[model samples]
Structures are given as C-alpha cells and as structure tokens.
Target: MTQISIGVPVFNGAKSLDAVLECLRVQTFTDFEVIISDNGSTDGSKEIAAGFAARDSRFRLVEHAHNIGAKNNFLSLVEEANCDLFIWRADDDLCDPDFLAILKRHFDSNPELALAAPRVKFVHDDGSPNYEEDFQILSDKIRPLRIGDALMGASSSWIFGLWKRDALRHALEITLPTYPYVWGWDPLTLLPPLLDERVETDANALLIKKSISTARYRWQVPAREMWEMRRAFSRTCFIAFRQRDWTLAERVIVGVYVFRFANLRVYRFWKTVRAQMREWLGLKRRQRRSVEG
Candidate 1:
C-alpha cells in the first residue's frame, strides 16, 4: 500500500488539533502518513502532534524556526512531503475515516484527473450538519468541465480537493510566489482553472467538520472578532445587492472583496502586489550589497 502524504499546516491550533488526530486514526484507509508542518504555534499543538508521531509510524512533524506565515507554511509542507499523492487538511478541519480510501480509489481509476475530491459534508464542532445549508462558495465543490460533469454539484469534497503531487506542485508553480505566507492561498485556487484538470465530484464524501464551531478566521485570540467582520460583510452585501443600495456598497465590497464570494474567490491583487514589492525590495537590497563588495 502506497502511503498518501496528508499535509496539515497549523499555528497555535491547540484546542482543535486532537480531534482531527483522532479522526485521522479511524480512517478506513490505513496506508497514509500525516505530515504536520508547525508554524510556530505557541500553544502545545506541537505536543499533540508529537503524541501522534509517537503512536503512529505514519505520522511525522516539521517545525519552522519562526512562523513562516500561513501560506508559506502550507507550501513548505506540500513541497516537503515524500508522497506523490497529497491532500491538504487544515488543523481546523476533521476528516471521515474513508477520506483517503475514497480519494485514492479515484486516483487509481481515473489516471487523467489532476484533481479529485470526494463528497464533502460540513459539521459544527459538535458534529451537526444541515442538509439545507446553502454552500455556494465555501463548499469545496466546483462546477465540473464537460468531461468532469459527473463530479459536479454536491457529489464530493472537491472544495477541500486532492491533487496529484506533481499536479499540485505544477499548479503552485503557476499560481504561487516563491515567497510564502498565509492569507493568500484562498484566492490562488483560481489556479485550478489554469491547469484545466477535472475534479472528481462523484466520490463519496471525505467528511469535513468545522473546528472552531464559528466562522472565525484569525482563530488567534478574541476569535469572535473575526466573525464580526463576516457578519458585517454579509449584511453589507445584503443591503447592497438585495436591498438595492449603492452609496457605500462598492466601497464595502472592494474593502472586503475576499469575503464577497465567502472569502474564496475575491481578488488578492493588491495583497499579492504588496507581497511582490516586499520581495523586490529585499532582492534590491541584496543586489546593492553585492555591488558594493
């Protein structure tokens, strides 16, 4: 059995890490390794990973000297994984026991699929899922292409999709900067469009449970503050699109563009530009030093 490398990136995710690990243990597909890349978590999350590593030969952990930011942390783990098959699981999410098995079967059956994901079901921290939930944006299932239509519409966890190691690396080459950090990978999902890979939506769900119970993002401290922003964005869009107001709508939309389509589809142009500028400045400084030498 080939071991699939599951890349999990975490930062100060103590409260929710153990449950995910527990879920990982029960996975029906046993041939897999869990690689946790630590992003300088202050909490004892590393200890949690260490416990798992001690118990399971398939579990391994990597620590960053300092926090490499969220996005780079993800790339660092993905790039470091030894397996050709990979899936990204966040510290804040839970998986069904059959996740690896279902996904792997699709990988073996459809040799052409660059990306494959099983049905994704979301649950609260208490493991409650609502069938009536409208998950247009954050659900992980994307509209399939002509050939990939079978995997479309609530069929799979394509939202938290899986990719061939090489395919993901190539897509990252196209969409990711050499520099890494968090807060940017969401928008980069657009790279899948560029790769033209089909998503397998027909596979059974790889269960996805929300870690914190709330939609808070920072998950650092005073976490609810993150949700307040979400509530504000949702209200603003409601007032703008549904209420037919325009005065502050555009400004609000632009300001929180990322949160527009539920935070996954908005343009990261400005943020990406700012990141590039930092890289440029750093490179220029090094070049000047070399010239002076």
Candidate 2:
C-alpha cells in the first residue's frame, strides 16, 4: 500500500488543474498516489486530469456522472483513500515539491501526531507574491499546539494538512453529517482534528495556496443555511463534550469557545444588516430624485 494519498476534487478547474497536477508530479516524495475526482465538469477538467494520469502511473482519475455538492465530493475523496496518510488538495492550489517529504519525515517519526501541516504561502494567479506589504509568518521548526488554541486558529489552511487515514476517516464519519453546505463550513469540518491534542505544524512554506475567486469562502451563502450550520456545529460540540477523554476544565473551555462562536455570528449578522440598510437607503434616495426629475 502507498504511504500517502493525495485527493484532488475538481469541477471546472481546468485552468489551474494542469499546474497543480504538475506540482504533484515533481514532488520530492514519490511514495504517494494521486486520486483526482472530477465532478462532472464540461470544461475539459476531466481530460486534463486524464492526461496527467496517462503520463504519471501514480495518478488515478475518478469521474462522477452527476455534480455532487462540494462537501460530498470532499468526503468521497477521503473515503477513496487507501494509504496510511491522506491530504485533500485543491485543483487550483500549488504545493512545494518538498511538502510531502517534510510531512512524511515528521509523521513517520512522531507516532503521537494526528495531523501535520506546513506553513501556507499565499500566491497570486501568475505565481507572484501575495501579502507583499505584510511580513510573512515564518517558523524555523515544527511544533504542536494545544487543542483549544488550534481550533481557534483553524481555517482552510489546516484542513488540507496531512492526516492519519483512520483518524481522518473517523472524524469525518462523525462530523460530516453535522456540516451544512453553507458559508464558512470549512472550519466546521475541521472540528474533529482541531479537538485532537496531537496536532503539529511546520513553519516551512510547503504549500502555496492560490487566492482564486472561488477559493474564497463568502459569508453570504444564504442565511438559513448559515443558521442551520451553526446549529449543527453546536450540536456536534455538545456531543464532543460528552467524550470521556476531555477533562472538566477542557469541557468548560469548549463551552467558552462555543459562546464566543455565537457572539461572532451575532456580529456578522449585525454587519450584514447594516450593509443592507445602507443599500436600501441609497436605493430610496435614487428613486426619489428620479421621481422629482
């Protein structure tokens, strides 16, 4: 069996798919398999992936007849993995050739590590530097963080990290059903890993995440959906609270985290309301001026 599995889920991502596949092809670590899942794309994404598979014996392509939603596609990729380690790679993202090598060394040496992630370097479409004005966060070494701190800092960056296949599978099986396909659902999908005490991160920029338009998670993907997701996430947290492993102090910290999350939601709702009100008032002013004229 392969030591690592890289699953790429694509839908009309032909434009950047080739570059991503090529990045994988040149990885310093070769004991890996690439599984590309095409979500019924008409934009030659399937052909691009197929071509890569043809050239690279390690690359495999899976095509779906219907367009399954993004969440399902992601979960399916994990389910298809057979290796001891797995990572969900975006078709539009680029990874450093040494990404797998660095992760492999750390994971193989550290039996207690549940998830291993590298520092993320954001780049433009043309491969130019992003965040030029801001100093990049650099890490000279890989280290583990407390579970609560990791969960608070969790985002899409950590979600793509290398995971122990069995741990990831169990996490997904427990968390996916609670995930609502709404705005900012990525962090929710990461709850299980974030709660694990053995998460580690390296400061090396082993992953280059391209800031594509569709890659950004918007907060406006239907209010009902957002509400449903928050509800589901809260329920899942309570379920987590019942775990025998967590201490009373840890459970209290989790409760505090949930409270903070609720406050964040309220803040977002007010911000949305204020923006809508401004738009509505602007429209009224325009209509009145038009009527007078």
Candidate 3:
C-alpha cells in the first residue's frame, strides 16, 4: 500500500489540470498515490486526468457522469483513499516538489500529529508572487488553547494539509452536516482534529495558492451574504459545544474564543457599513453642489 494518498478534486479546471498533474508526477516523494475525481467537467479535465493516469501508474482517475457539488467531490475523494495518510490537492494549486516529503517526515516523527501542512504563498494565475501568509501553528499543548488557536488563527488553506485519514473523516462528519455552506467549510472541518490532536506547519514547505483577481471584494458582498457568514461562524462554535468528550471547562474556553471571533467579525461589518454610508453621503453632496453651481 502507498504511504500517502493525495486526493485531487477537479471541476472544470482544464486550464491548470495538466500543470498540477505534472507537479505531482515529479514530487520528490514517490511513494504516494494521486486520486483525481473529475466532477463532470465539460472542459477537457477528464481527458487531462486520464492522460496522467495512463502515463503514471500511481495516478488514478475517477470520473463522475454528473457534477457532484464541490463538497461531495471532496468527501468522495476521502472515502476513496486507501492509505492512512491523506491530503487534498486543489486542481489549480501548486506545491513545492518536497511538500509531501516534508509533511511525511512530521507525521512519522510524531505519531499523534493529526495534520501537517506548509505555509502558504499566494500567487497569481500567471504564477507571479503575491504575499505569503504568516500562518500561526496550532500546536498548543493545552487542548482548549489549541481549539482557541484554531478558531482565531487557522488558515482555510490548511484544509489541503496532510492529515490522518480517520481524523479527517471524523472532522468532515462533524463539519459538513453542521454548517453545510461552502463559505466556512475549511475552518469548520479543520477545527475538530485541531481541538483534540496536534497540528504542525512547516515554514520551509511551500504551497502556492492561486489568488483570483476578479473575485468580489469583502465590502462588495451583499448584507444577506455577510449575515449568513456570521451564522456559519456561530454554527462552527456550536460544533465545539457538541463534543461530548470535552470537559465543561474546555468547552467554555472554546466558547470564549468563539465569542471573541464573533465580536471581531461584527466590528468589521460595522466598519464596512460606515464606509459605505460615507461614500453615499459624499455622492449626494456632489450632486447637490453641481445643481447649485
């Protein structure tokens, strides 16, 4: 059996599919299997995945006739994994050749560590460098503090990290049904194992995340969307409360962390509101002055 399984979930990602597969083909760590699940991509994604599977015995392609939603596609990859160690690879993201090797070393050295990931470096689609994230490691010895640390500091990209298959499966079971939206899926799924087990981040290993320039800005999002995001955060907090294994004090500590996170979100929301109000007032004043002149 392979030592690690990398699950690649693809949906209409023909543009970068070949390049991503090439990256995997040349990984310094060769004892890993790549499972690519193409979710009914009308693009040439299926052909690209199949091409890799044909050329590389370690790479396998699973084609779905219908487009399963992105969440289900990701979960399906987890279910298909045969190895105890697993990592999710997005169709467009690229990682250093040694990414798997570095992460594998951490898991081998520390059997209790549930997740190990590299610090993320954001890049444009053209592969130009954007900013790198200063990701805080969530390895606190105190379990409650670990939960708090995950709540406040964990990056969503950590979802792509190498994880113990069972821990990841359990986390998905807790997160997916609780807060079913795609907006906060990463942190929610990442929270459970982080609460109970160790997580390590390697500054040396680099995962290049593609930053889309045309995506809507935070302030441009509608009020209803913002409210739903807040609701998602609250639901994530509820997941902590549902942990029957946690002590009351542990639950309370996580609750305090959640409260602080919520307060920060509210502060940002009001700040955006004030900025929009000022812009509107200035626009109205300009119209009045033009009419008087």
**How close is every model to the real structure, measured as TM-score?**
0.63, 0.81, 0.82
lDDT of 2 by residue, 1-293 (tens): 78999999998898989999999899988999999999888999999999999988999999999888776777789879888899989888887788888877778899866778777777887888774111222234222224545555544577788888887777666755665444445555556665655567776636788765452334333344445655666666556545536566766776676555533532255555554565556533122111000
- Between which residue pairs do clashes occur in model 3? none
- Looking at model 2, the pairs that clash are none
lDDT tens digits by residue: candidate 1, 199-261: 454435555756333322322312233334344433332332333223464434433432334
> Could you tell which candidate, 2 or 3, scores higher by lDDT?
3
Candidate 1 C-alpha error for residue 86, in Å: 0.4
Model 2 reaches what TM-score against the true structure?
A: 0.81
> What TM-score does model 1 achieve against the real structure?
0.63
* Higher-TM-score candidate of 1 and 3: 3
Looking at candidate 1, what is the lDDT of residue 280? 50
Which 10 successive residues of model 3 have the least lDDT summed?
284-293
The lDDT leader among the candidates is 3
Q: Name the candidate that leads on TM-score.
A: 3
RMSD per prediction, one decimal? 13.0, 6.9, 7.1
- The residue ranges of model 2 lying beyond 4 angstroms of the native Cα positions read 132-145, 212-220, 261-293
